[model samples]
Target: MSAAPQMNAQHINAITNAAVIIVKEHLGMQTGFSKPYVSGSQFMSSDISVVMGVNGTLEGQIICTMKNQTALSIVGSMMGGMKVETLDEMGWSAIQEFGNWVAGRAASELAKAEAAIDISPPVINEGRSTFRVEKTFLTIPLTSEAGEVLLHVSITPRVNE
Candidate 1:
């Protein structure tokens, strides 16, 4: 792993899989979640992008995003159903919970690799799906009987510092 700003594919996979495992193990889901996809987004609508700050030598935030359909399916399975037609308030609440789980898993995985990164609690966010070159991100497609979810992870250095 080339550290934060220049993360290698290994490190990225570690974090992405951790989140996927959390969703499956915790939510009792059984399916195949696709490998992580690292790409730029033309727009950021129709998805939830959450940023979590990490304070350290290479500081940045992990931005996790997912589409409405994915969120609804995951949330519905979490609530003992899979045919989620509409994403109601309860869906948002559940999505937040999922985000929380993902953040915790990512942070823990990083820590195990001797990367002292602290992730703040998940927060709802909206923005474009783009990042700098030295920047690194992970996009995972979660597959399940319920449906598939695209989880995006972006890493950038702290500019405020």
Candidate 2:
């Protein structure tokens, strides 16, 4: 096995920008992100989380976490202001589609910097949970009108044997 690939400033910027753009474009809400920091192999998620795997040039996971209310608010906005008190099956599917939008946007942004990547289908986790991995993650907290959404990015270059 080889050492994990280090994510540089450019990669981090691309990811952060992608998240911000997605929130603004899809949810029609502006988002401001805080300073990104590195985390250990374990991540404590919030009430709801959307986890997706990254492959191709990069490998790892990107997780979007937020409070249950926040999830409802986002789903509401995605559904054109329909009030969402609970996450029904359709609401849950909307949340997953939100993750897909972020992942697709991230891939596009990374490709602009010459990094081709593929994102897996998103998996939604309801309730708090801890995600453990072998590689460190770069976490960025994005604040918007709906609420605070944490974007946990753990990615490294895929080494070819």
Candidate 3:
């Protein structure tokens, strides 16, 4: 872990918008951005996702997390049925793939802007009910037929100057 990634309002907005586009486009749902949740000792926890950060010039994370219901609905929608009750192996895989797509989309957006961006492979977690981030700079809320999950982008950018 190098120094935490630092980001500004513009970068935050850019990342948020790009990430949201990826989810909405895939799940046919809309992701909302509300007041960010702060982090401290034993802070709130949500989903654990692939945290990609570019340390050379800019630094940030492309975090993705979806609730079980959300994941199930998304998986169900993709498979053309709502009969699915839970996220099976196939449903889990669907969530991971969606995570990759969103991360990749965000990276593409940054790359198009000529920003150095590094992305990590998607990491799948079960509920992340106890996971905690030391930093809470940015957060995004996604809503689907399943449910809503929060994506908190905790980056300590290097370009604070």
Candidate 4:
């Protein structure tokens, strides 16, 4: 197996900032930034997680985790008052789309830092799955009227870099 990519200070700052900006703009809420930390895998165990793999200048995964109520409330508000008591298929889809949108925005913002990234489709994990980070990650807490959600972002400069 190959070693993980190294993330410079600039890359880290850009990625973290992009994540916070995208989430706050999309959800229209206040977000809190957390200091980046290293964990021996299992960075998070959440009720639901929307994960997407990224490639290009940066490589790693971006995960969005939240509780059932948080998901419902956010999706409900996004869809214009659509009731969301539980996470049905439609709810899952909504969350997936939101993750993709956020990642896309982050990628766009990364461009300003000369970092080109490509995000894959989001994979939904509903209360069952153990995702290993296998590298240092940054977690940012976003609070809204609904509840608190965490963004687990792990990206490193590509090997060629």
Candidate 5:
């Protein structure tokens, strides 16, 4: 196994700030973040999660997790206050787009700190699941009027080839 690359504080800050900004600006919800904590071996995800991969200066995943009701509420807010009783195809697509916005903002923030990075398209995961990785994850729980969303971040400096 490769040695674990050091995770920079700037990178973490950039990602968390990006998430908070997106929630506030796009979702129109004020948010507060709890202290970040590290999870070993695995993370038990919520009912719904949007996972995106990061590469370039940093490598790993950024997962946005929340309960099903929270997801529906968020989608509803995104759709101009339309009530979303269920997650239809359009709702799922909106959720994915939300993830894309977060990732894109994170990339922009990282770049401002001179950390060039690329992010993959978001993948939505429904139902509760356990995510295991050799690398540890730093989870930040963001509390908002809509609900609590957990941001699971596992990123490290890229190893030189």
Candidate 6:
């Protein structure tokens, strides 16, 4: 088997830290980020996942996965106490926006290392799905009172000098 890619500790740390900060600031919820690790894009346990692309200094994708119920709870909170029970069009839109917000913030934080990165608009998907990637990915698992949010980050650094 081919060896997994080696990620810069600083880069991974920046992404993880940015996720924690954005979730708290944007959602008003405390979140915990697990140490990032390199792995294939395995199917997530969650029913809903928001996927976004990373381009520019790094090229890859970012996926924000969460359970359906958890997605509802988060959307509800974002709506300021409104109840959300289903993954309808509105729910999907909210999730995509949330994913965008997180990814944008993360890319900005990553750019602090002088690596210019930009995130693509989010695509929301429901149920279980499989992802295939040749390069190993940096996966960050985030936990909150609502539920778990898995951040599947895959990137290839560009040569900038």
All candidates' lDDT scores?
A: 0.63, 0.90, 0.61, 0.76, 0.92, 0.77
Model 5 agreement with the true structure over 40-82: per-residue lDDT tens digits: 6698999999999999988999999999988998999999989
Q: List TM-scores for all candidates, in order.
A: 0.70, 0.95, 0.74, 0.84, 0.96, 0.87
| Candidate topping TM-score | 5
| Candidate 2, 17-81: lDDT as tens digits | 89889889889998897877777799899999999999998888899999999999999999998
Model 3 residue 129 distance off true place after TM-score fit, in angstroms:
3.4
Whole-model alpha-carbon lDDT for candidate 1: 0.63
Question: What tens digits encode model 1's per-residue C-alpha lDDT throughout 37-145?
Answer: 5655332423566656656533655665666666667777788876788767787677777777776787677666666666777776544354443444456676765
Off by over 4 Å in 5: 1-3
Evaluation by lDDT, superior candidate among 3 and 5: 5
Determine which window of 10 residues in candidate 1 has minimal summed lDDT. 38-47
Model 4 gets an lDDT of: 0.76
Q: Give lDDT: candidate 1, residue 81.
A: 72
| Candidate 1 deviation (Cα RMSD) | 4.4
Please tell me which model should have the higher TM-score, number 5 or number 6.
5
**Could you tally the backbone clashes for each prediction?**
1, 0, 6, 0, 0, 0
At residue 77, candidate 3 shows an lDDT of 66
On lDDT, the candidate that comes out on top is 5
Please give the lDDT score at residue 12 for candidate 6: 67
Q: Extract clashing residue pairs from model 6.
A: none
lDDT of 6 at 7: 56
Per-residue lDDT tens digits of candidate 3, residues 53-154? 444356645566665566677678667655678777887777777777766676677666666666666667675655454555455665544576566665
- The TM-score, computed over Cα atoms with residue i paired to residue i, of candidate 4 is 0.84
